[model samples]
Target: MKWSEICIHTTEEAIEPVTNILYEAGAGGVVIEDSQDLQQTFLSDEGSEYSLDPADYPIDGVNVKAYLPVNSFLGETVEEIKQSVNSLLLYDIDLGDGRLTFSEHNEEEWATAWKKYYKPVSVGEHFYIVPTWENFDPEDPNRKVIELDPGMAFGTGTHPTTVLCIEALETHMSKKAEVLDVGTGTGVLAIAAAKLGARKVHAVDLDQVAVQSAKINVKLNKVQDVVTVSRNNLSDNVKGQYAIVVANLLAELVIRLAEGGVADLLQKDGLLIASGIIRPKKEQVKEALIKSGLHVIEEMDSGDWIALVAEKAE
Candidate 1:
């Protein structure tokens, strides 16, 4: 069978939402190529053996590629995908170069083309995001590992926004705390919460594919007993309150959640770790959090991304 490979050159902040758009548009799976990945240093000697091919990656921005079967209506489908991806601007998501390109390829090529870009990545001080196909043993026995196969969903746990969230989880997550992970793509943060000793984690995402991916990863990491994957928009259907609420989402989405009473979802003195904000929107997000009755406790910055930790006021 022949397949059409649709590739979008966009920013790291746009990866998760764009991948979801492609999945919803009937793409079988997605591949992400980030220019930043080329700069990551190996944590173990084993990592040195795997060499990355420069020809496969973009020199600037990020590329999200998805495969769709070639058919009579391929043109219409491609047009629809373009329109949907363009719609992300409504949410203030940075598309970077925002170039959409495509090519025709065989099914065999589509199956294996994305594997080389994925590798085991160490995030934060205690966690390693290992691809399912990779054999990874943590150099430190005390370090926790999350085995993941993101499939068509986002959240490899290596993105700066995700890394900041995991770092905050490691620092602020209390033993036995009940946690809520809004927009839990790949369930990375939720699994990290479970590994960090959170007694219970409610991992919620509006995307069904992401919910399934998170479920698989949570099970793979042996955290299903502690993390429950569910389909919910923001905090809409969630009940009760949580000791910690973490959301790695677009800046506009974060603002909307804040304006929509995200604080009500938290217990008194509870922490909210908000990530996925570019430096340009950091203060805007912080203001929204403050308006929602959250007091800023800490801020984490990596590259141009920022993650804010806020607490419910007494």
Candidate 2:
């Protein structure tokens, strides 16, 4: 039940790289701590700015906070952990939550606390998300349903980015279309596509845990036959063109993939739905998609989150 926190102090420039390394090293979750989070942790409640001199913080740029359950097989020996931690010479490591001046807490205990925040959420008229421990009376047997226990994958149907992608899929998917969900965080989008009548759905992610979690959610939805999960990027190993391609990833990655000829994997008239785009970077992604021979077909927004649906030029 104990949760071990690994705090990596690195310049803002290296935080992402360090995050990637630590993630590969077996951390369950990697949180990039921005100045805002730091301010909130130390200054927010005081109704005043942080009084500490900026130099006191490893505030050269940013910090990475990773969380792992103590009972999980993240790593055993301090030597083993240090060897991985030491790989980042430019960064410092704190084995506990150094940011919060408080006692450590158990995650298994926190897991129960987190459940109180979860409630049945509806994505659209035809679909409803039911937590594994909750029950729902189906108003219609044909209504699409997805049961999920979001252990640790990114998409939980809560974030604006996720909902925007779902809305984009709903706008374009047809009963006979094949769907390819890139970066399928909890397989939520792919499952929704299948229930929305996608003939076949292929879901992929670079994280093994995400892949496994997607599989679990797909099984829970009883859509295993239509949803195929894999741990791979869309680079070269992926095959065939899909009628609908969904990539709910960071804006930069989405832009790169769109321009990097990944659109060639889409059918001539296929739809490409991309989300996880911050407000500021939207224009860059739109330009990239245009340069990649796609025309913007639709745009959906939820709060500051945005989703773009483009079609490969016929």
Candidate 3:
């Protein structure tokens, strides 16, 4: 089998939003690239580092690939796939007839390709990220370990959202506090909260795939007894309040939850840690928090992403 690489070149401002659109349209996955990355990886040898200009990087969009069946698709059929991706992309590429080619990998090989990116990382003093397949020897045995694997999930502790949440946990999480992790992709944040001494942790994701992935991750890390996994929408079967609620979702979803979901799930004076906010939408989320009666305690940034630590009004 084989695959085609569809490269979309758009103004630097439209990447993530465009990527989401493509994903909704049936993209198997996406690879985000800017001219700099493209130049380094394909055209030059500099390889991902150069004079930094924020605007030079694509901010508001993404490129996506629609995988076609390599077995049955002829070159002409492949061209149709290109057209499909290209139509959604709204960018120009010079693939002579706009036909790109790819070689398909067996499932094992494809999975292994992503496995190479997983490694152990320490997100905080007491919290460590260890991929399920990797061996992690913590420098201090007393430190807490959070096992994770990206397998079909979005986080393995490398993304800005994951890092920001770790920073939030380091700064404000309290011993014996109950934690609620909304959109707990791979359960990374919940595991971190558990390691930080949260007495109980409840994690939920709308994707059934994510729910299974998170459950496997929690068990892989030996935190199954402390971390509960559920396949429900954020507000679905969840009742009762928690001392700390962590939500790493799109800026819009974060704002909505800040006003409604978090407002109901958080105990008075409880803490809310939210990320997945782009720089442009930071103020929107801040305003939402205030509207929901949460007072901002602190805010931090990782690249263009922002995390806000807020407290429910006492």
- Among the numbered candidates, top TM-score falls to 1
Model 2: how far is 117 from its true place, Å? 2.7
Give me candidate 3's TM-score against the actual structure: 0.74
Candidate 3 whole-model C-alpha lDDT, 0 to 1: 0.66
Per-model C-alpha lDDT, please? 0.87, 0.69, 0.66
| Number of backbone clashes in candidate 3 | 12
TM-score of each model, in listed order? 0.94, 0.72, 0.74
lDDT per residue as tens, model 3, 1-314: 34443445453234434444434444454454333332221101221223334443454333323333344434665455445545643432121222233555444444354454345655656665667776556665666767776665555665656778888888888899999999898888888888778899999988776788898888887788889999877655689899999988877778768756577788878989988777877888899999888889898986666889999886
Residue 276 shift from truth in candidate 3, angstroms? 0.6
The whole-model C-alpha lDDT of candidate 2 against the native structure comes to 0.69
- Report clash pairs, candidate 2: 12-61, 12-62
Each prediction's RMSD over C-alphas, in Å, is 1.8, 8.8, 7.3
Candidate 1 regions exceeding 4 Å error are: 43-51
Instruction: Report the lDDT tens digits of candidate 1 across residue range 174-235.
Output: 89999999999899999999999999999999988889989999889998899999999898
Q: Candidate 3's error at 137, in angstroms?
A: 2.9
Sorted on lDDT, best first, the list reads 1, 2, 3
Model 2 Cα lDDT, one tens digit per residue, 120-219:
5556556666667765565445556678877766445655577677777777788879998888878999999998888999999888878999999999
RMSD of 3: 7.3
